[model samples]
Target: MKAELDLARAFALEEDGVTAIEYGLLAGLIAISIIAGATAIGGGLNQFFTGVGNWFSGITVP
Candidate 1:
């Protein structure tokens, strides 16, 4: 009974699991932010390139 109580107390005091979960959540959020930023930048670059291409296509050379 004493050993069981000690084991229960140790389990209750453990923080490693909680710390690992917190780190995992933080990493997931960082990854999501990076993906969102990259997507936005990629869309803007595509539009800019398309506009430049259209503008160049309108020019004629003798």
Candidate 2:
């Protein structure tokens, strides 16, 4: 019984659990920010590059 209680106490270490959760949340936030920024700028960047390519193709720059 004492061993079981000790094991439970170890498992219940609040600092470890909190740290794990904090890191997980931080990673999640970072990933979401990357996705959001990519989505917001992806199309415009692609369009600008495509336009530049067309401009260099001796065709009118649209």
Q: Rate the local accuracy (lDDT) of all candidates.
A: 1.00, 0.92
Task: Report model 2's TM-score to 2 decimal places.
Answer: 0.60
Candidate 2 structure lDDT: 0.92
Per-residue lDDT of 10 in model 1: 100
lDDT of 2 by residue, 8-43 (tens): 998887587798999999999999999999998998
- Model 1 ranges off by over 4 Å: none
How many clashes in each structure?
Answer: 0, 0
Worst 10 residues of 1 by lDDT: 53-62
Write candidate 1's Cα lDDT for 5-56 as tens digits.
Answer: 9999999999999999999999999999999999999999999999999999
